[model samples]
Target: CSTFLHKLQRKSNRKRSVVSSGELHRNRRYAINPLGHKWDHHNLTYRIVAFPNTLNRDDTRKALSIAFTKWSDVSPLTFTEVTANATADITIGFYTFNHTDCWWSPLHPCFDGLNGELAHAFLPPRGEIHFDNHEFWILGKSRFSWAQGVWLNDLVQVAAHEIGHALGLWHSRDPQSLMHPNATYTGQRNVGQDDVWGIRRLYAADKKRVCDPWASTSASANDEILHEKNCPLRCDLPLESELPPRHVPRWLKWSLRCGHKNLRTTQNRYKTSPRASRAEGL
Candidate 1:
């Protein structure tokens, strides 16, 4: 999810109008749509597996489920545990040893830092996860805060971050985001807006075109058609690239001309559209 942002930003905007020119007759391509439908209507269950050592089984399980539910709220996806020996689209597991250096972090910024890399998860199609066994996997106060910490790093914070990875989110560089490489206590209570937006974008693609027979697997096919074929207008558009991000909301716009880095500001920025500029007093 975090890595996707860097990739998605490179693509140019798509045109949605109906055109008859053969050069403009774009082929259908598969891209994740931000505003697309979710998988909740379908009878799909994402199985989450856990390997607990120090963390209580019940509380850890509860926390993992809660993390998935956060994405479920924005997505129409439903998940359930598979009790039997069955394979699933997404599988969850934990690690106690540091055989793979994925959990080791010389770059980690946590207060205790090195002892706990907190948590890590593999992207979809390769589901693997590991948590630091050295940390107190229980819910208790940390050395930093005096508050009763019901959600420790190994449990709540790590679970949330791993779940983000499992959902196809890449780590975000933004400090306030849940997908950031470092974990924070504030991120545990809720998924950050950016995390939600990223998950919604990733799975939304899976919902609409993951295996859709009508769409191209590579999204670049849209620019190469030499023959004039009557294609669905909606299909030709960048499925995931066109819509504004979930965090953008309906009322707000990204004003590059505003010269304000903050998204929330009272003064509207300059605009190309005179009417909109006038409406906002830009």
Candidate 2:
């Protein structure tokens, strides 16, 4: 493991780097890291600049390999490891404090020793995934260690989430999606449909669909939505009920919940001048 001084030195060399320091986007569904900072190509390369001391190189690589696979299974993108990070598009590391920074640094001032701010990543074209060395990372079935009184962060799940940011994704509000900002260590690790659309919206070639996010919802579905919820005109639900649907696009649900005015506001934000991606902390 080495200082990310290597990453800082090469700042001038990246194609279209992202800073992740702009205004907040909508708090629901999936977001492209603001300013639409995505990898322009599907085939990308990554490098692991550091690792946890508890694990060996081979095991750590395998964990990260599975994390990248979660994205490749649903998108046209691909990731290859390069021993030389200087040529790699994305770089991974584990750092404790000011030597490295992320979207989360402002709140806790880099890694908050122990359970807070487990990790954060930069958006695409500046793919830097940094993990917290303070937390005990594991590739196990459970997330917390009651015996040890600490959170046992799953390396694979957290890597997948950071990889989402590296591929130009923002934190999603859909609780079931892997991109959700809050559920990273609570065992919601699967890539949901929101996660799939978030990636495809960034890299897909087909541009036929209209930009209206709510246009696809018919009057019938809208009626069903309104009738199903007691709160007419508001899509509010208890946290326990925000499960992602099997075949529905997340926008439809967002539209139904937010109503026309808020939906228009959200659409306007995208239409306005682009800002950098927001810091998505865990």
Candidate 3:
């Protein structure tokens, strides 16, 4: 029993260390890493296979739809929802514990239960986003008022972040960017300029007409169109002074650590091995 307890303590400490390292890496610079691949085509379809019990079907759909819109509005790519089809370029769903990353499963890096990690996504062609169903997901603005015990992760904000991953973006060091691994819960929904620039780097924008009346007389229509389309939305990167200060609530960190303790206790009862413990219905 002492050996078992020691092992569990080591594992818990390791997990906490990883969390700390990830937090540090997420606040460094603009681009931390890249998926190294992107979709060949611009148009993409997504399907929501499962919904969380925390939010109704309509609310879940709305939150996800808004997330998709947030990306499409800034980028040249387009996303269409496929309700009838089970397969799509992107598959979004909610799973608890080790449902997606079981020993026998092909996928990996599963949810770490209620807290610790909220959600994750596969990059580019894989296009899979999985949310920890155990989370207290705040779907709409009004829903947060009724939230009680658990930390309420904003659905739209998380969705937008995950969607950025699905589109081939890596974790950004900018805390204000949507692609930041540890995105804050500030109730702001729009994707940051850094995120927009990242996606643009992956997929070139399709040709679109622009109205520019003040261009030099020598500049042809095609030249004006090229310049206007290349610099979509004015490319105003957020200055360091203008960026909001990183704000993580003290209670959130405490809640996650407490949740990890419960998870550790549950794992110990089943078995020390993650696969064996998961198989035994943890």
Candidate 4:
């Protein structure tokens, strides 16, 4: 769940989007979509509907595989790639600015080339993830060369962040959690305690309740989520909680435009503080 404001500054006007990537806070817990979106089953399948030219297929698969494991390691959720004729539960692709029709359902914002709005993904059931093809995606923890003009964005890190969205996780208030929206493009990240709490709670609640996925969506307080009041009934309920969080207001996008700076020395690169932009869709 990172945002164009992630430059994800989430790039969408739809209410279902959860564009991410900004902000940090003390050790806190994670958050779920207020509307309540999540998989009912622990075993899940995903497929690469599209792959980026910037990365080799083998490397891309390798990276994404590791990223999915980050979640499975902390929860009962298991992810398997579906390459055969069968349709997968989740799909991933990369697109540039205005590649998809904005008027259509599940709408999202156009990519802005380099900085803001890095990537966005849909919450559960829709299972779609999109990335900006324009960025310089790379493998490894985090390293960039001013001379080579390569401001490498880590595929593993960003994919992991977006995967959280597909899993129905919103941005975590915890700065170190992999679900944190800000400072994503800068380096490698792992699942933190806050994230574990979120994922576990989501599925745990899922098993204990009865939901009606087709129930017409309605509105109430944010606390209504995860309370097991209705076990998040209504296939598409009143809330379609999200992450990667496209589908936010346009004005918020401007505020989400944050960047890093002044890494003048390679030795001190790790010490560079990322811009503290507001975490979108939090």
Best by TM-score: 4
lDDT scores in order = 0.44, 0.59, 0.58, 0.61
What lDDT is obtained when candidate 3 is compared to the true structure?
A: 0.58
Which ranges of candidate 1 are over 4 A from the true structure? 1-50, 98-114, 139-154, 185-188, 205-282
Q: By lDDT, who's the top model here?
A: 4
RMSD of candidates 1 onward, in order: 16.2, 14.8, 21.9, 19.6
Question: Per-residue error at 43 for model 1, in Å?
Answer: 5.9
Candidate 3, residues 1-282: lDDT per residue as tens digits?
Answer: 012222332432332211121122222233423336788887899999988978888888899999899988777678989975556999999998877654443334556676766776776788888888998787754233454756777888889988887887765555678766556454546788668666765663312122122211223335434334333332211011111123322221110000011212232131122222223343
Model 2 agreement with the true structure over 1-282: per-residue lDDT tens digits: 112422332343333323221232233366665477888877888898889865667878998999998988666577889985368999988787664544444422466678767777776677888888877888754466799998777888888887887787766657888877765655777788667756766764212222122222433435344423322112222111122344334433332222212322332232100011111110
lDDT of 4 at 30: 67
TM-score of each: 0.48, 0.60, 0.60, 0.62
Worst 10 residues of 2 by lDDT: 273-282
**Per-residue lDDT value at 73 in model 2:** 66
How does residue 115 of candidate 3 score in lDDT?
70
For model 4, residues 124-167, the per-residue Cα lDDT tens digits are 88888888888777777756769868667888888888898889
- For model 2, state the Cα shift of residue 115 in Å: 0.5
Q: Which stretches of candidate 4 lie over 4 Å from their true place?
A: 1-28, 102-107, 185-188, 205-282
